[model samples]
Target: MLRLCAASVRLRLGLGLHPSRVSWQRQLGTHGRKESREPLNSPKRAKEFIYRLQAGERSCLLQELQNFESIAIAQETVEPSPPTAAQIKYVLFHNTLPFIGFGFLDNAIMISAGTQIELSIGITLGISTMAAAALGNLVSDLAGLGLAGYVEALASRLGMQVPELTPKQVDMWQTRLSAHTGKAIGVVIGCILGMFPLFFISDDEDKKAKTDKAKPC
Candidate 1:
């Protein structure tokens, strides 16, 4: 009781001495974060947020595309020529998402590669390989729905479905599984867009080296 009273007294004294120090929650006179105001079940609010996110993505993609000229190429003395084995491999893996998850990826590639990651970037339409992958995101996701059918077929073939009261449960599980599978398709597409600039630097260096060697001494 005394502790409570003392805490209350201290709080009052602090408020009196520094009125500007009022807690942020109290100042706002609200108990919820800004986002909390939007009820998740409200389709209008949800659609608004999604639209805003898409608009922002489009804006960013436009900005990046506009800055292409700002990209400067520099060359230095280096080993391995243009289209060297490493460059080929890097571009291959970077463009193909670690060779469709079969090829070994270095730390950087692994860290940066992912279809969902690339699709989220949504800024590679200017590049051929990336453009194909980005544009294919929806088609791939739709095709992924086949995985759910495969699961159902496999379960029926194997008689894995429980005999108990589970038709609804199984249906629910299948829906979720199919949704996840569909999303994976987009990730695969995104991986196609991720690329490496390492080879570009080496190729530039190789070109410069050849030119310098050919110059009159």
Candidate 2:
């Protein structure tokens, strides 16, 4: 019995000394790779990779912008010469937006009466008034343009640098500038004078309000 028991004890000791099959498989999943030495996904490495990617993106953007600048420079070299006399005239008086706006202001001043008719004058009277204003504006513009030409001619005779625009286009531009300036000033003056009626209206409104308030309680 003692000999058999000693054999069984030796077998148990051998089994304990040796690793179990299932436990070894569970613990050594990577098989040959050393554990805890190098990480597959380290935070430091990931941050560095992201930083490199951002740097690459920035570099590409800079390159694209540089290319665009070069293209713009090339296009500029191919374009017409920069602003001079005509361009100066264009900027000062004949710019697309300002020219349209100034002319509209002139027309609006002449048409203000028809626009400000508060009473229901009916459609026909309103249309007639608007037509009269339009016709009047046309006549005024023609006279102003003629005067501008005459003045420009006189200015030339007076030995001014006005002849620098002897070129037909420039002369026409000068004439236009003169006419538009005269018209705009005349309209503004007319509009100011027309405000006289507004003063009377306000006075009448005040008197009416006072009478209403003073009525017997």
TM-score of each: 0.20, 0.21
TM-score of 1: 0.20
- lDDT per model, in order? 0.32, 0.36
Candidate 1: lDDT of 121?
A: 38
Among all windows of ten consecutive residues in candidate 2, which has the lowest summed lDDT? 17-26
Give one digit per residue, the lDDT tens place, for model 2 in 31-73: 2234333321698644543353334444543454475567656
**lDDT at 69, model 1:** 25
Mind sharing the TM-score for model 2?
0.21
| Candidate 1 lDDT by residue in tens digits, 23-72 | 21221222123433443359986565335433444454345335432331
User: Cα lDDT for residue 139, model 1?
Assistant: 40
Clashes of each: 2, 0
lDDT for 77 in candidate 1 is 28
